[model samples]
Target: MIEVKGLSKRFGDIRAVRDVSFSVEKGEIFGFLGPNGVGKTTSIQMMCGLLTPDSGTIMIDGKELNPDSTEVRRKIGFVPQETALYPDLSATENLRFWGGLYGLKGDALNSRVEDVLRLVELTNRADDKIATYSGGMQKRVNLAAGVLHNPSLVFMDEPTAGVDPQGRFAILNIVRELAASGKAIIYTTHYMDEAQKLCDRIAIMDLGEILGMGSFEELRDQVGKGFQIFAKGDFDGPKLAHQLRKEYEGEVLHSGRGLLAVVVADATELGRFVAAMKAQGVNADDLKIKETDLETVFLKLTGRELRD
Candidate 1:
């Protein structure tokens, strides 16, 4: 439903996004995963026509996106990272205002407001002022407003951030329902598990560029197969790390606090490493094998350095 190519943006001397490109399909959740300052927001803004890109083309439903085109802009719904609601307004009032902006009015607007309130499970608080609601409740209301017009495509940036687990779950279910109902969603979040669970395809971004793009398994395969062994017991962590590095050509990610996190190329090496550790008088109290997750793949592709 959407296509972006060679999307790049710059502010002054800083390039917030550079040659970043990806697409979202109908009824699919395309995850834009990255750390802070990785150009996720800038790219989204450009795609949503909220900001002009320095370079690249954006097409929605096969038509080239014109930021100034009201018809094109009306086809999208944006649920921003921050709540976009009036504190003094009731949830129903907020939805009415947003729907009116989308040219919704009278019975059509009222019907949509009711449907969205029910979709977000906020019907009970629809008449309550937004300021009086809890943070999670306010977030739900924000989500309701975004979908009030039932846009075919939605950009949900960190829709679940800072919400309670229940709220997060509800939001996730809503995303699934939206996709099932044939809405193409471009979802961005710092949460790896959410991306893994919801996204049909993911694009990992960093330093204003797309580092990797594919399904979870596809991205994991790019990082290669590996097993992380966590063992807790009495052991010379540094000494064992040195030995593993030499013998099996493995890397010790962590070594301290009566625990060792070792990465091995082959699973068979796990047993051998355990025996070797025992031979070195390191008695293992607990040993567990951890499969590589999205976070691991992200770190591998993006490096372990903290980003601002």
Candidate 2:
């Protein structure tokens, strides 16, 4: 239930976000994905009423974003990219402070604190100081504070940034559980795998612009068949490639060694390519086709490596 239209933000002469627009449906996990410094945080800040955009509108449940409105803040939760938690306070104490800020008190506040702590699986450590918790634990606590108020919409910025693989999985599971509970989530990350697993739809941003937006399959189809076919080292390269191209109308590139890069419209061509290769005395079992995934789509669309 969040909508952004032509959202643009400028810092002096530089624009952090340029006419970027997208929407998040109620109870859906929408991903805001991009590389570093690509306006992800800037856009999120404006949506949370922490920063005002220079141009555009952010509407939440038909109510336009007003930076000073407590009513707006009441309906939204923000777990920032950075840790805004108190290192000295216990997990339960930290949540207590946050819950109180939202006008929660007495039994209502205490129940929320326990509910979110359990949701993040920090109940056993709820009384321990945050400094004793690992980075993942701290991030979980950070997430708990955001949702302690049970806001209808939550914005998570790099929620799993410093966590290990296990922690990342735990955090991802929590996000999924939240969506199942009917919370609309705006999740941001640089990890393609995370986005692939967590998002119902994704908006890929780069250089302050939305380069693409759609379901993962829709975006993957946009890149066509960038798949590759690899075979054993002794197989014929060019002659076999020529026959496969003639049969399937595919582009063949030698992928070094005996591996052949076959680009075609669909995987049905992959079967035909294998059959042709077998007819020419090559072992079909030695052939393997690698489907183009989201990482490949990102590299093609941004023309840059994810680490770069």
Candidate 3:
């Protein structure tokens, strides 16, 4: 339902996005994963008509997107990272106000307010002031407001950020439901697990560029399959890490805290690893094997260095 091609944006000397391109299909949840300052937000703003790109084309539902076109804007919804609702207003009041922005009024507005409230499961507290609600409840109301106009596509920017586990789970379920109802969703988050759980396709972005894009298995293949060994107990963490690095020619991904994490290129080397550890006189009370996950793929593509 959405297509972006060669999208690039720059501010002064900084390039926030560079030649980024991707698409979102109907009834699909497309995940935009990246650390801070990776252009995820900038890219979303351009796609949603909030910002104009320096170069690129954006098409929604086969029509080229024109930021000045109200008809095009009416086809999309945006759920920003921060709460967009008024804390002083009740849940129903918030929805009503947002619905009115889309030119909804009277029965049309009231019906949509009720429908969205039910969708986000906020009907029970519809009359309660937003200030009285918990963080999770407020988030639900924020989500409801975004869909009040019943747009075909939605952009959710960190919808579950700062939410507790239970609340996160609830929002994840709602995201699935949104897709099931045939709404194309573009979801952005720093959380890998949430992307793994919800997105049908993912695009990994870094330094204003799209480093990789695909389903979980497809992207994993780019980095190749690997195995991680976590061992703990009476072992010299740094020394063991150094030894493993020398033997396998692999870097130690983690060390310290009485534990060591080593990444090997091949899973078949498991037997050799045990023998080598024993030969090193390393005694371990605990050992666990971890398969490559989304986190591994992300770190591999974006590097492990901290980003602002």
lDDT of candidates 1 onward, in order: 0.86, 0.85, 0.86
Question: How many angstroms is residue 231 displaced in model 3 relative to the true structure, after the best TM-score fit?
Answer: 8.3
TM-scores of the candidates are: 0.86, 0.82, 0.86
Error of 3 at 182 (Å): 0.5
| C-alpha RMSD of each candidate structure in angstroms | 3.9, 5.4, 3.9
State the local distance difference test value for candidate 3. 0.86
Local lDDT at 226 for model 1: 82
Q: Write the per-residue lDDT of candidate 1 for residues 214-284, one digit (tens) a residue.
A: 99999988656688777778777677776656455566756765767767776787888877776666777
Give per-residue CA lDDT, model 2, range 45-145, as digits (tens): 98999898889999998899896778988999999988889999999999999999999999999999999999999999999999999999999999999
Q: Once model 3 is optimally superposed onto the true structure by TM-score, how far is the C-alpha of residue 42 displaced, in angstroms?
A: 0.8
Off by over 4 Å in 1: 230-243, 251-262, 265-289, 305-308
Pairs of colliding residues, candidate 2: none
Candidate numbers sorted by TM-score from highest down: 1, 3, 2
Residue 128, candidate 1: Cα error in Å is: 0.6
- What is the clash tally of candidate 1? 0
Stretch of 10 with least lDDT, candidate 2: 252-261
